[model samples]
Target: MNDYLKNGLFLAAGVAIGALGAVALGKGKFSIRPAMADLLSHGMDLKEKTATVLERAKENLDDLMAEAKHAKESREGKSVAEGETA
Candidate 1:
């Protein structure tokens, strides 16, 4: 086929597809506002839940770190006492 003919055919196909899509969309009562609002609402809820989970994890990690530090200090104290006896 000729290049010009191929280009024309593609252009016609694109127009036909666009026209059909527009007609289909026009026939439906598809409101994007409500869909977007619902999505944002869910996103906010997820954000809140994630923040809560992260906060709890931070608290648990802090407690674990404190306990580890105290354990290390206790071990050091025991080693010093043993050294003094020797």
Candidate 2:
């Protein structure tokens, strides 16, 4: 009924068809195992890279949040310092 729903269903069907086609083609001339194995062998590298990226993101976020908190406190502290009770 909805345009978004219809479009989503169409996109899903297209992805399903493409996946089926890849599997069918793999059965003949393409070997999915070796490729997947190569990727799997790099699993550690992927994991380490992902962890490093996440750690850096978390550290940056923490630093930013701390700075934001300090700024907020400074703004609020000004009012208290000026003899205003809020």
Candidate 3:
């Protein structure tokens, strides 16, 4: 019985708020379009920043891999020369 009463009150409150929002929207006193646009603008900015950071990270990784490969080849060539001399 107590739970039912609580649920009923919550439902009533929701209906009241919905009705008020509808009235406000009908009168053009409140708008969600501008807010949505701002949200989307921020989202776009974040996406661009993330893409740039990822590209930079990929370039850095490529440079490190090239350096490592060169170091390995140099070591192998030195060992082969030393073996030939022996």
Candidate 4:
């Protein structure tokens, strides 16, 4: 009888601890509502910042390509002049 009682008490404590853990980890509805809201807000802000950075990168890439083309044309002209003199 005493052994049975001890077993019952241990089982009950285990169940209570498990319940508390589940609640703390947001397993139940309404448990993690505030955390979810914060995550969504931060995600939105991150997306906006990422888009802005992408736009700036695109503009910089275009400028670099134009500069490269200009440099290539100048080099070609110099080569042609050298060939004519030789």
Candidate 5:
């Protein structure tokens, strides 16, 4: 009987502590001003635009590399022909 009473009291104390902790750690309200919201949206748009520019730059770089490779092959072929003639 005494053991049961002690156990019940412990359980009640644990429940009360948990409830208090939950209330203290709950999230509060959040609000953003209209000007700040517009700024944030504009920033996101700029990031998307920058990403598109970088993608185009990467494609241009690839094309340049292909052209350079072709040019190098042509130069090597010419050098080989000159060597044979010599």
Candidate 6:
């Protein structure tokens, strides 16, 4: 109930949780990298983000079209496009 006791408990809980999290991330594919990755990824954006997203969108659409072509070629049933050459 004392203010000092509450503060001590809070500090202790923070330390314990931090220690546990550090240990958990110590060895894994999800382990935290250096601050550079976070700074570069989370900071800035605005104009850069829009262009980056649009570029990725174009790439994704190209990939999707390639997949569709592969699927169309693989189909064994009646030709869906009729006269379209393989």
Best by TM-score: 1
Candidates by TM-score, descending order: 1, 3, 4, 5, 2, 6
Candidate 5 wrongly placed segments (more than 4 Å)? 1-32
TM for every model, in the order presented, reads 0.64, 0.54, 0.62, 0.57, 0.55, 0.35
On the 0 to 100 scale, the lDDT of residue 78 in model 3 is 100
Expressed as tens digits, the lDDT of each residue in 1-86 for candidate 5 is: 69999999999999998786566556424333565579889999999999999999999999999999999999999999999999
Which sections of candidate 3 miss by over 4 Å? Answer: 1-30
Which scores greater on TM-score, model 2 or model 4?
Answer: 4
- Model 5 residue 85 distance off true place after TM-score fit, in angstroms: 2.9
For residues 1-86, what per-residue lDDT tens digits would candidate 6 score against the true structure?
99999999999999998898687777565645665477657666555888899999999999999999888786743475554655
Question: Could you tell me which 10 consecutive residues in candidate 5 have the lowest summed lDDT?
Answer: 24-33
Model 3 superposed RMSD (Cα) = 10.9
Writing each residue's lDDT as its tens digit, candidate 4 over 1-86 gives: 69999999999999998798687776564567787689889999999999999999999999999999999999999999999999
Residues 1-86, candidate 1: write the lDDT tens digits.
99999999999999998798687678886655676689889999999999999999999999999999999999999999999999
- The number of clashing residue pairs in each candidate reads 0, 0, 0, 0, 0, 0
Extract clashing residue pairs from model 6. Answer: none
Q: Could you tell which candidate, 3 or 4, scores higher by TM-score?
A: 3
Locate the minimum summed-lDDT window of 10 residues in model 4.
Answer: 24-33
Measured with C-alpha atoms, the lDDT of residue 70 in candidate 6 is: 86
The C-alpha lDDT values of all candidates are 0.92, 0.89, 0.93, 0.92, 0.87, 0.79
In candidate 3, the residue pairs with backbone N, CA or C atoms under 3 Å apart (3 or more residues apart, or in different chains) clash, namely: none
Scored against the true structure, residue 52 in model 6 reaches a CA lDDT of 97
List RMSD in Å for every model shown.
Answer: 13.2, 5.4, 10.9, 15.7, 17.1, 16.2
